[model samples]
Target: MSARRTSRVLALWCPDWPAVAAAAAADLAPTRPVVVLHANRVVACSQLARSAGVRRGLRRREAQARCPDLYVARDDPDRDARLFEPVATAVDATVPGVEVLRPGLLVLAARGAARFFGSEEQAAEQLVDAVAATGVECRIGIADEMSTAVLAARRAALVAPGTGAQFLASLPVSELAVEPSLAGPERVDLVDLLHRLGLRRIGDFAALTPAEVASRFGVDAIAAHRCARAEPERAPAARPPAPDLTVEYPCDPPIDRIDAAAFAGRLLAVRLHDRLADAAVACTRLAVTAETAAGERLSRIWRCAEPLTPEGTADRVRWQLDGWLTQRALRGHHPDHDEWTGIATIGGQAERPGASRTRRTAPPNGSADNTVAPGRAVPAAPIVLLRLEPVEVVTAGALQLGLWGGEGEQEERFRRALVRVQGLLGGEAVLKGVLSGGRGPAERITLIALGDELSPAADPALPWPGRLPIPAPAVVLVDRPEVILESAAGAPVWITDRGLFTADPAHLRWGTKDWQVAAWSGPWPLDERWWSDGHADAVRAQILLRDDVMVLLLFGRDHIWHAEGLYD
Candidate 1:
């Protein structure tokens, strides 16, 4: 069989879009140093912050230390999408049929745009000017493949037709992770593995036979291999979707609130997935279209690396609706206007179309807010109809279920529930704990919001000389209570300069309670960050009391003993 060819694509990337959106939300000056953080690690930084030695993956404290006046913001996907709606709108106005890869990146077919403008360069210039009109900077790149186009956009380069492989050859293997929306952040591991195997460049990785990559690296590596070879994102198996596959929902009273839209979106997503499954196919590209009561139409296309699951489909639909409604609200349109606020109940119970309702009611337990800003109204025009159409479809395969009854299915359901809860509350409402390198139990774990990257603050595999051994304490204290460790003579116990205990710990007094120490382990010295001004010198020891209670204690340089953790 012959190698598949890639299509000509043009990509546009907005640099540090999260930082830009955050700055705009906070009304910060453009010259102010800013960074967007997730999981206490920098994910994006403004040019001003980069100049001050701030970079992605740096810890919050380190970033703050590098730039004293740095303004830090949390990574908010909803905010990013809401703020990016204008930019996408501008690009759509300049060149129609723009596909949003994510909040900060978009792509379109270059062939049509280039021909209309007489040259690819001219088309790119127009796109840049369109985005600049919105007060945001962007870079454009044209290439024969989506991933290559995205990388090229980072450098503002244009690759000639049929030269995509050559264009990708010299780049480092790490570029595989450049487009997280395409390759996903999981590519970080793949890139690291490739680096360790001496495949330092894309050309080197591409040189290996497909069979070799498949046998050695498994199924996930196949997509990366194809990308290295500059082939299409997927096998050229996509075909026009069947007409009956299109799912449409007509709102009788016209839904205006975001919570109602989200509810409608969930039902629509489920119907679409069921239809696809019945047709023995899966959706790779989805087009969401909405029609307002005033006959206004809004549409967007979302491309996914893998076939979209039900939860994924719902997420994309909700995000697109949010962007549209929020953008309208920000433009001073109110849901209370006569054009909107005609809905009665979203759950199949409808009132008259032109009837107006003004009272604001709270959504169900897990529905999102309606307004973009706290006090702003919903969209001016209520949605009269919503449609989900599959632009590209691929044959579905048998799902491998776990031996013990649907473990994977249960996990997926739980994850969807968490995402729903997160939408109802905020991003930080649900948190996941990740392990990292640190001497103290509390320091060893990092709590990051769910759905964010699981990157740890420090490397867990690195050597930590004074880290606690196996069988860690069951309970970690959030507030360290000051305790008094004394010898048999009732004198305060201390640590010597040589990292040794001055006296045997015989008595423990915490608050008004006292207990006799039955046994104790040796004090382990931990002198952390000695090079920095905020260095900490502390020693820890595990102690057993007469009441059969075991606790971990830390003696700091300030001559205070605190109960750090408790054992079950």
Candidate 2:
């Protein structure tokens, strides 16, 4: 708090932001469920998956069964992160210091920025324009804090400051990410739970004490608490520095020679120091402007060696000019008659409008101007060629030519291989461990993201429960089993590797095999997923695998079953 009101923050949320962004680089769509699983392994299901009735945590079998027409795709977090870099840069241009909350989220300090850039709304628009340059459609949210800002963005509209809590109060409880709980035959969704608890909206949640919520939900209550009323944290900026003085020298003749450009920079620096001395302020960024002789212009920004004074500034400028002149003179690129004329400007606006930090500028060594006379006009003001503007602040990321070079593709593959091998060698290797909180083991089987923890589905068997359902077969075959099934008095007919027979019931023979139905159970009926569009889970059945184990099978959307799940 620089004697100013608390800093407001802006948070932007990009919708479908990951896949939508992936589409820009490469089209990866073909009717499959696309979920962006985070480093935390929580899946952010795509809209396509939702339409198919596949949700974030449905079992893999159930999801596929729900929409046999569905596809499963891996989520790329880094790609998602890179997609928003340009947008982040754009925001940096409009308002420098920004903290990326997530791949599709941005949080920026708004207190001083709002005042310096005008109003909160004006700054947001400017930021929007900057993001527009990156060709992204983003929803901007501004509020008193990070949490409110996030809610604002999610709502897909601007929410006035001082009113974030009210706006948040209007969204549904499900929007906060709640799970259903098993009570009777059917469980209760979070909305019902909230209603049961007598809490209406997020605002209502935000109003409760964390202790009160914890008493009921346990640790999960914390997340619920956040959902009810959570705000993200802001970046630190105690006393944001404003500039003491900034002076610009417009060039008449566009500057081309390093010597001439250097001279102009010196003059501007001198003027800047005089003003700074008067106002008693010191800044971090030094902006240099080069207006070309033909009106084509270039501006270079730099930081200072220290709290720069006019004399120190002039020496540095002369040194820079001399180096420029030498480079041109050696290459003979300068005209035999004309010299480049330009102006250099220096000052601070928000620490450095484009710079991420307030650091001093240091001219390269071995290139200082040691030949300038004590008192000499390094050429009179060339001309009002262009109005010089200081260069903005720059971070290391901005100056790079390639994306952040982390590991190569080969290295990544090797790492994955190593993990797999290590796991197999350890013997405790469980490739997939699904939670069957619902029906049986087969139904509980799940595929985990390589490093993610497996979670159990909601507990569906309760109230009157003592026995556990047998797990389904791990591997399923599309072809009916090659065997003949005959009742106490009958001959075999159908035969295949897929299974014994359809619900119509007729077993068969295979290879040199023939087996009759002795004491058999049922083709226990499993319904197609009501959630999925194509009826994935519509036709599922269970069978006893002789005496070995019980196997669950599915008559999937594709009319196939490669054995579903297996029981212990």
Candidate 3:
């Protein structure tokens, strides 16, 4: 058998989509500088914000500092997907078989559409116009592979067939990390490592032999290597999934509510994942189908660059169900209606020609009824059954599970447990600690809710003048307790303005307890916010007691000594 050629894919990308969704949801003016943040880091910013030096990964404080008038919004994946449905619907109307890579990105086979529209360029223009009609701006790219097409979409370029490799040749290796929603975010680190190894360009990395990349990097890098070479993401061994692998869930009362649909989708996704795992295979392309009470069948195919994990599978199902239910809700009246209007605005921008064909009105109950154009058929009833079928499967080796019973298995189990607990207790119930910049132990740590982006409050790489030495305290006290450090002469020990100790520390007393100081380390003074009225002047020291217990003590300008932390 000869080698299989890469498929021609068309990718549509909406830049700064999170910012756009946020602005539309908040009804912010188009000229306003907007940023959407996750875990206190700027994940997406509007064009206005970008012009002000705001970029992804910037700390919230810094982003705001760069643009003081920036309007900040939390990242809401549901909102992004919900608002993007019309755009996707518009594209689906223009060309069938649209595969959603994520909320703001879409991909499909370009051959048929190109032929129908007379050329690839024409199809790209038509798709762009379709999306723009719904009040959103988009860029389209056509290439021989989905990954290549995604990158091209960022530049609005079209790569001629069989020339994907040459087209990607001079692009920076960092391009591998672009559109993280399509390719995983793990590519960011891979790109950095590639740069350090002098593989600055995509072609340089692609030039390496497969065996070389396999020996030097992990599974992700190997997948990226294939992409760099403009090859298919799946290995040639990919086969059709077994018929028995299909999983389905029947909704008792039929699910019309978005929350209910989300719950049902998760259950079905887990079941499908378990079956795939049992079969020792992983799904690369998933077919999500839903049957409504009116016998209406809705189906969509989602293609992933990486094998679908349970979370990824669940997310796709939820998005599809949400899109289906939202479209139903938007239509407001009976699905049998043939006329409706398009969305009025996206990212707070006015709709273009062919936009605003639908007018959303409030029902008697005073709630808004969101409706979209009647281009695609809407389900006439609530969804009664949800099914998942693996359209394409590959051996589970792609998942990189640990050999036998190893750390990978253990880590996966542990992560599942955390997710379970989080599901039961709400997203903020569980917390994880992230290292951040500060002079004191407590200030150096930031507690973030699990499932959020683990961004530190400050950059740890920056120099902290009065930071504690090599080993951090084992325990940082949330409440500072008053203590007394005195000399053998029975006078309170103090640090002079010149930074000299008035006397050698002899004893320590706190709450009816006392200990003799065996040895002590001197005052590391910190004058924080000295230029402002909230300025604080403090000195900290490490003290060892006769009992072998160690304590971190601080003396503030209040002339009070407080125990700050304890060392094990």
Best by TM-score: 3
- Candidate 1 lDDT, tens digit per residue, 184-244? 5568899999999999999999999999999998566888999888877653236778999
Which candidate would rank higher by TM-score, 1 or 2?
Answer: 1
The 10-residue segment with the lowest total lDDT in model 3: 363-372
Model 3 pairs whose backbones collide? 330-370, 330-371, 341-357, 341-358, 342-358
Give me the runs in candidate 3 sitting further than 4 Å from their true place.
1-6, 235-237, 339-375, 400-568
What are the per-residue Cα lDDT tens digits for candidate 3 across 347-435? 43433555544322322112111222233345668888888989889888777564443223356777789889999989888888999
Would you estimate the TM-scores of all the predictions? 0.64, 0.39, 0.68
lDDT value for candidate 3? 0.79
What lDDT does candidate 3 reach at residue 191?
94
In terms of lDDT, which candidate is strongest?
A: 3
Q: Comparing candidate 1 with candidate 3, which one achieves the higher TM-score?
A: 3
- Output the worst ten-in-a-row residue range by lDDT, candidate 1: 364-373
Candidate 2 Cα lDDT to native: 0.47
